[model samples]
Target: MRIIFAGTPAFAVPSLRAAHAHGEVAAVYTQPDRPAGRGRGLQASPVKLEAVARGIPVLQPESLRRRSAQQALRDLAPDLMIVVAYGLILPQAVLDIPQYGCWNVHASLLPRWRGAAPIQRAIEAGDAETGVCLMQMEAGLDTGPVLLARATPIGAGETGGQLHDRLAELGAAVLADGLGLLRAGIRPVARPQPEQGATYAHKLDKAEARLDWSQPADALARKVRAFDPWPVAEAVVAGERLRIHGAVAVEEMHGAEPGTLLRAGREGLDVACGRGVLRLRVIQREGGKAITAADFLNARRDLVRA
Candidate 1:
């Protein structure tokens, strides 16, 4: 089968590679290069980088809503179009061009998390389990029917970054299986998403990363994990920015007010929260390398706001 692959981020790279191995990928479509980092240099997306490495043709169009762009995709004469975290809305015209139709590799099960940032939202919501979904493309926002799914438990201490990698791998494997089924003329029965228990996972915002001490310690701990490796959970200490990368919620402590440091040592920094103590295990000073709580407490004594 001749396939057209569409994706942009690191989460989509694995699925793109899997599609290439499963069939002849005629071309790849990705978002245009964007300015990145403090230097603001234009950087190719992860999918584009991988596609270039494999010598696959790449198209970086600003929008596919244009008739010309949709026509360009049709010219490829692809039997199937595989999309994963493509970061663009596919018009119905584009969806109708492929012979076998477009299949999306979504990060979460259908109806549960139906929009951007599903992986992070799942962790932040403290969901017990999350998984990948192979869905047939439609005009609605992830409202398409799911043809295949594979479940995985969300570990208690798992961070968003950790779950993101695992789900990427799982999505690739399920996509491969789904493709095989389609090629063998075995159309897997696609089930409509349940109307109940549906939720949208909105895109993450840096503003939302600010730590709210008034919340319970357990919730704060979850926030740190959910926002790990991106706009990390932040708090101000002695007028200096502090990023909390690792923490655990412990039983409530007496005396100290919320957001006050109750204790600091090699074991952990026990900080009071609304309902319990949050033992900070890993932390980072603004624009500095992440270090253990002990190192941060010792090197910067002013950080402990007791």
Candidate 2:
């Protein structure tokens, strides 16, 4: 079967590989290269880089809504299309082009976290479990029936970066499963998402990374985990602004006001919160690399409690 794969980011690379391995990847659709990094040079998406390395044809269309773009995809005469983390919205006209329709490998379970930034949102929400869903594409935003799914438990201290890697691999595995069934002349059953329990995961904003000490320590800790490897949680500790790379909630009562520096010891830099304490394990000062809290204390002797 001839397949067309569409994706853009690093998270979609594994699934692109799976699709290429499963069938003939006649073409790859990804967003146009955008200026990135300090030098502001045009950089190709991770999916485009992989496709080029494999000698697959790559199409960087600004939008599929354009008739010319849609016609270009139609010219491929693809039997099926697989989209994973493809940033552009697919119009119903484009969705109807493929014989088998388009399949989307989404990061979160259907009906919940069904928007951009699902992976991080799940962690930020303190969800106990999250998973990937292979859904039949529709015009709506991730409001399609689930074809296949794989669930995994969220570790107590798993950061967004860690869970992202795991889920990327899991998404590829699920896509492979569906492809195997298709090759055997079988189609997976599509189950509609329930009417309730739907939650939209809005895109992440750098402004949201500011840690609010007035909130419960546990929530702040979750935010620290969710925002790591991106807009890391930032807070002012003893009048020094620092990025929080790792932290944990400590259930201890401290009469000090929220955001107060409670203690700086070998274990961590403990800060009083509204309900509990937040023990910061790793931190980074402005224009500095991340360092252990102990090392940070060594530089600022004033914060180290005797």
Candidate 3:
């Protein structure tokens, strides 16, 4: 099968490589390089870097809705297209170009989390389990029929980054298996998702990173995990921003005013919350590297009460 692979981030690289290994990858389409990081240097997306290293043809069209972009895709003459975290909406015309239709390896199970930040949303919502789903592409937003799915239990203290890596690998395997079935001329039956219990994974916003001590400790801990490595949970401590990287909920009954530093010792930076205490295991001050709560406390003795 001549496959045209489309994706953007590191999460999509695994599935792209799997497709390349399984069949003939005619071309790879990814988002273009953009300014990133402290220096604002142009950074190539992970999928683009992988495709180039593998010697696969690479295309980075700004928009597929344009006639020129659509023509470029048609020129590939691919038998099928595989999309994972592509970051671009495919128009109906482009989705119709491939003979076998495009298949998407979405991070969340169909009809449950169907948007940009599924992995983070699952952890934020304290979902017990979440999984990857291979869906036959459609015009609607992740409303496609499901082809294959692999479920996994979301660990109690799992972070967004960890879940993302696991799901990426799982998605690669599922995509490979789905492609095998397709190659054998077996069209996998589509399962219509239940209309109930559907929710959108809205993109994470910076404002959402601000931690409100008024919330329960468990919820705050989940927020810290969900936003790790991106928009980390933050709070205003002594008129300075403090980012929380790792935290654990304390089960003991000791409590103080919400947001108050209940204790600052070797155990960790135990901060009181509305219903419980949150032990800040790791922290990063503005313009400084990440450090353990103990290290942070040692350096700034004044934070012991704020």
Q: Give each model a TM-score.
A: 0.96, 0.99, 0.96
**Candidate numbers sorted by lDDT from highest down:** 2, 3, 1
Clash statistics: count for each candidate: 0, 0, 0
lDDT of 3 by residue, 1-306 (tens): 999999999999999989998899999999989999999999999999999999999999988999999999998898899999999999999999999899999999879999999999999999999999999999999998999999999998899999999999999999999999988999888887787988999998999999998889899999999999888899965456889899998875654678877777666787788888888888899899889977887888886765
Clashing residue pairs found in predicted model 2 = none
| Candidate 1 local lDDT, 1-306, one digit each (tens) | 999999999999999989988899999999999999999999999999999999999999999999999989989999999999999999999999999889999999778989999999998888999999999999999999999999999999999999999999999999999888877889878898888999999999999999887788999999999999887998864456789899899987566668887877787888788889888899898779899988887886765554
Query: lDDT for every model?
Result: 0.90, 0.94, 0.91
Q: Is candidate 1 or 2 superior in TM-score? A: 2
User: Tens-digit lDDT track for model 2 on 1-306?
Assistant: 999999999999999999988999999999999999999999999999999999999999888989999999889999999999999999999999999999999999878999999999999999999999999999899999999999999999999999999999999999999999999999999999996999999999999999999999999999999999988999999898999999999999878889999889978999999999999999999999999998998899998863
Please rank every candidate by TM-score, starting with the best.
Answer: 2, 1, 3
Best by lDDT: 2
- State model 1's lDDT: 0.90
In lDDT terms, how accurate is model 2?
A: 0.94
Evaluation by TM-score, superior candidate among 2 and 3: 2
Residue 299 accuracy (lDDT) in model 2: 93
Full-model lDDT, candidate 3: 0.91
